[model samples]
Target: MTAAQYLNCLQGVMQREWLRFFQQRSRFLSALVRPLLWLLVFAAGFRAALGVSIIPPYSTYITYETYILPGLCCMILLFNGMQGSLSMVYDREMGSMRVLLMSPLPRPFLLLCKLLATALVSLIQVYAFLAIAWCFDIRPPLWGLLAAAPALLLAALLLSSLGLLLSNGIRQLENFAGVMNFVIFPLFFLSSALYPLWKMRESSEWLYWLCALNPFTHAVELVRFALYQQFNLTALLVCLGLWLLFSLAAVLTFNPQRAAVRG
Candidate 1:
């Protein structure tokens, strides 16, 4: 395809997603509510119960709301990624997936565009959550907000790619319940999103190892350190590498034909 053709496709895909985002205004509010609920209600109780040791990116002991903000930020992205993939299943049923793939553009590029569009939408919601958190006094450095943009985008992409892989790999068998049970919660709860690895180790060595190995943990770490204006080379490399791998796998194994048949 010509350069203009590629640009047109990308623009169309992104515009369509954004338009839907606006139409379902409740989704945006719903996304914010999850994190805010945890931050305001759950974190408050945990703040007193769990004494958070001083960790990197923290100079002194921090409040639970402050410590959990990054994870909550990620929670937005995490759920958005799932929602985006869930849309893919809808599109497949409606034959939109077939129409999109029938474009003259390369299939891989088209899938990449979809992934990009999803991540872009999620990034906007994440920032909206962060802005609301700031008003509640869970503030990070002002410069950290700027630094977090790229980190958030990367995390969004990584998360969206993983979801895409699951839907694309597992043919239309049943509902998203399998994914929610097996993928989403496990990744979220097992990661360092809520608790530090040291604490997990204090509880169970194996659980700590699992959290350490989870890429979502790295994604959270990437955002956490970025929000403090610090760089974590390990997290940067892990998230980047996995995003590439997962994106590639999703693109390669993309089966619109099978999805269409099943849908």
Candidate 2:
């Protein structure tokens, strides 16, 4: 497709996703509600029991809610990404996938556009959660919020691409719930989302290593540092690399020709 045509296709895909998001109001509310529950209930319960030290990105001791804010923001993205991918599975079963694949645009470019569009939608939920957090006085610095935009977007792209990659392997909608639970909970719990890596190490060294190895952990760290207007080069590089790797894999797996050969 020509450049203008490709742009048009991208715009159309994004608009479709946006319209679908509004049509399913429950999805938007649930996305917001999950993080709010974590912030309001779960974090409150843990506040007294868990104490955070002055870590590199943090200048002083912070409340448990404050500490987990970035992780929870990422959690919003993570779930939404997988939800977006689940929609892909639904589309496939509904015969819409064939239509999308038959477009004049290159399949990889189309998939990339889908990934970008999904990432953009997930960002809306992330910022919404941040706004709610602000009302509760769980505020990051104003500049930190600005600095977080790129990091949040990167994290969104990383998770969305990973979700799309998983969706390509999913052959049936019936199995998607199982897959989502298996993938999402582990990624969220095993990372430094709820607690610090040091705390995890104190409990079990192996668990700490696992958290360190998790790409989601890097994504969380990228947001964590950026929320404080700081930069974690390691986190940035890991997230960037994983975003590229997952996007490439998703595109390859999404190829209709590959599916035909396998069939």
Candidate 3:
């Protein structure tokens, strides 16, 4: 397809995907509510109970609720990306994705547009959560707000690609529960989302190493740094690299013939 044609197809698919989220009001509200509940209720309780040492991006003692805001925001984007990709699989079975795939644009480009659309929706939800956190006085640097955009987008991209990879592999919703249980919680808890690597060190050096290796750790750190209006080259590289890798995997898994067999 010509460049203009490709751009048109991308825009069209994005609009369709965005409209899908709006039409499913319950789904959108539920997505927003889950993260808000975590930030407000669970994190509030934890803030009183837990003691966190000062870490990079945090200059002094901080409430647990304040500390986990970025992580919870990341969680919202992460889970929403998975949910959106799962919906794509359901749409494929229902023949909607087939209609999307039949567009004149290149197949990979079309599929990527879907991923971008999901990422956009997920990113917005995260920012909404951030706004609420600010209201609660869990403030990050004002400049962090603007710096967060790219990091948030990259996190959404990585998660969305992982979701696409899963949907491309698992043909039925029935099979998703186990993977979600096994993958999602472990990735979240094992990372620096809830605690610092130094804290994890007191528990197990191996656990600390594992968190260091986790791409999600870098994602959290990227946002944490951005929240302080600072940048970390290592964290940036990790997020960018993982995003590229997962996006390639998603594209490979969605290839027409390959997708058919998996379905």
Candidate 4:
């Protein structure tokens, strides 16, 4: 296909995915609600219970709610990425994914189209969550809101590539829930999401390094810095590197004959 034709097909698939996402009201609302609940109810109740030190990018005492908004946004991308991949797995079982895989187009491009579609959906949910955060007086600078766009796009690619890795690895859907719980929870908590690396260092040097080493931590930091209208070079580089690496890995593993010869 010509470049325009290929792009048009990509757009068509993405539009279909978006339409289907909206049609499922529960899925749509759940995406918005989870982050809101964490920001409003969960963070509010725990704001005073947790004492935090002044970390870079933060001055005097800040509420926990304000601190974790970016983290919660990361959570939305993380969950939505995996959820989208799970949907793909279900489609495969129902014979739809096979048709998708067999499309008269490059397999990697098709997979990327799906990933981009999922990223768009994830970004919508994140922006909605950010709007709700504004109502509660939990917001970053205006520039942060603008900078968050690319940060989120990178995060989506990182998480979506992870989802692609998982979907291609795990042939069964029933096993996904356990993987989600194990992977998502640890990745979120162990990172500098709710706390700073320095804070984690005070608790445990090991924990501090672990957080520093985690790519998600970089993803969160990139968003956090962008939220404050500051550019974090290291965070940006780390996130970009991981996005490229994971996406390449996902494409490699998704090849039909990678493991066996075709008949």
Candidate 5:
């Protein structure tokens, strides 16, 4: 395809994904409600139980809610990414993916476009969550909001790429729920999402290292620091590196024929 055609394809896919997302209003509300429930109901109990120390992106103690905000933002990306990939499974089964994957453009570029579409949608849900968090007094600086955009987008790509890679291997939609539970919950709970890494270290050394190794942890840290108008080199590097790795793998292995055969 020509450059203009490529751009048009990208735009078309993104617009289509966005329309589908907005049409399913419940999907949007559930995306917001999941994080809000944690912030509104669980934060209070966790805040009293767990004390946060001064950490990067924070000059002093912060509430548990503040610490988990970035994690929750990542959560939005994680779920959306998985949902996007789940749609891939649906499209493949319904025969649409065969058409999409057969385009003249490189399959990798097309998949990248799909990932970006998912990222754009995830970013919207994330911003909406942040806006709602603002009403509850979890305000970060206004500038920080702008700073977070790039980081959030990067994290979205990273998490979405992971889902894409996983989706390529999944032959059926029904099995995806079990796979999502396996991947998502472990990534969320084992990382620095709800608590600091240092706190994890105090409890268990191996657990701390595992959390540190989690790409989701790096993604969370990347978002957390950006939301405070700060930079985290390690987190940025880890997230970007893993995104490249996952995207490349997803693109190489995005074989709908394999899924169709296995199904």
Candidate 6:
């Protein structure tokens, strides 16, 4: 496709996702509520029990809520990423995806546009959660929020790509709930979302290594550092690499022939 045509296709994909997002107001509310509950209720309960030592991106002791705020922000992206994939499944079943794929635009470009549009929507939720956290005094620096935008977007891209990759393998909507449980719970619970890696190490060495190797862990770390106006070369590199790898895999595995047969 020509540059102008490609831009038009991109705009349409984004507009579709944006309209779907607002049309489902409950989806928006639940996305905010899940993390807010963690920030307000769960974090409050754990604040006294969990003592965070001075860690990188942190110069002094910080509350548990403060430490997990980045993770909760990532949580918003994580859920929305999978939710985007769920919509893809629904679209395919309804024949809308086939129509999208039939466009003259290259499949990879079309898929990338879809991924980015979903990431943009996910960022809206992430920032909303961050704003709520700030009100609760779990604030990162104002400048950090600004600096973290690219990091958050990268993380959103990585997770959204991963979600698309998984969805490409799923042939039916009926099985998506199990897939979500298997993917989301393990990725979240096994990562540094709720606790630091060092704390996990104190409990079990193997579990710590699992958290270390999780891409979501790096995503959260990337956000954590960026939220403090700090740069983490390792986290940035990991997230970028995962984003490219997963996006490529998703595009490759998203076979229109197979989808046609299945449908």
Q: Best TM-score goes to which candidate?
A: 6
* Candidate 1 residue lDDT tens string, 1-263: 68988999999999999999999999999999999999999998899898888999899999989888999989899999988888887788667788887788888898889999999999999889989988999999999999999999999999999888887755553677787689889999999989999999999999999999999899999999999999999999999999999999988877767645632
Return the top candidate by lDDT.
6
lDDT by residue (113-181, candidate 2, tens digit) is 898899999998898899999999999999999899999999999999999999989888999999998
lDDT tens digits, residues 109-206, model 6? 98999999999999999988888877878889999999999999999999999999999999899999999999999999999989999999999999
Q: Model 5: per-residue lDDT, tens digit, 4-88? A: 9999999998998999999999999999999999888999788988888887889988888988999999989989988999998
Better of 1 and 4 by TM-score: 1
For model 2, the stretches where C-alpha displacement exceeds 4 angstroms are: 257-263
TM-score of each: 0.96, 0.96, 0.93, 0.93, 0.97, 0.98
Clashing residue pairs in candidate 1 (N, C-alpha, C atoms within 3 angstroms):
none
lDDT of 2 at 18: 97
Q: Give the root-mean-square deviation of each candidate in angstroms.
A: 1.5, 2.0, 2.1, 2.5, 1.6, 1.2
Candidate 4 vs candidate 6, TM-score winner: 6
How good is model 6 by TM-score?
Answer: 0.98
Residue-wise C-alpha lDDT for candidate 3, range 1-263, written one tens digit per residue: 58888888878878987898788988877877887888888987887677998878888888888788888888887788789778876786666676776676777787789889999998888887788878988888788898889888888888888888888787677787777887788888899888888889999999999999988888888888887888889989988888888888878877464234353
Against the hidden true structure, what lDDT does model 1 obtain? 0.90
Question: Residue 90 of candidate 1: its Cα lDDT?
Answer: 76
- Which portions of model 3 show Cα errors greater than 4 Å? 255-263
- The local distance difference test score of each candidate is 0.90, 0.91, 0.82, 0.84, 0.91, 0.93
Over the stretch 1-263, how does candidate 4's per-residue lDDT look in tens digits?
89997989789889988998889989978888888888888888888888777776776677898788889999999999899888877776666776676679998899889889998889988998888889878878877799789889888888888888888877678988888998888889899888878789899999999889988898888888788877889989988888788888888888453323247
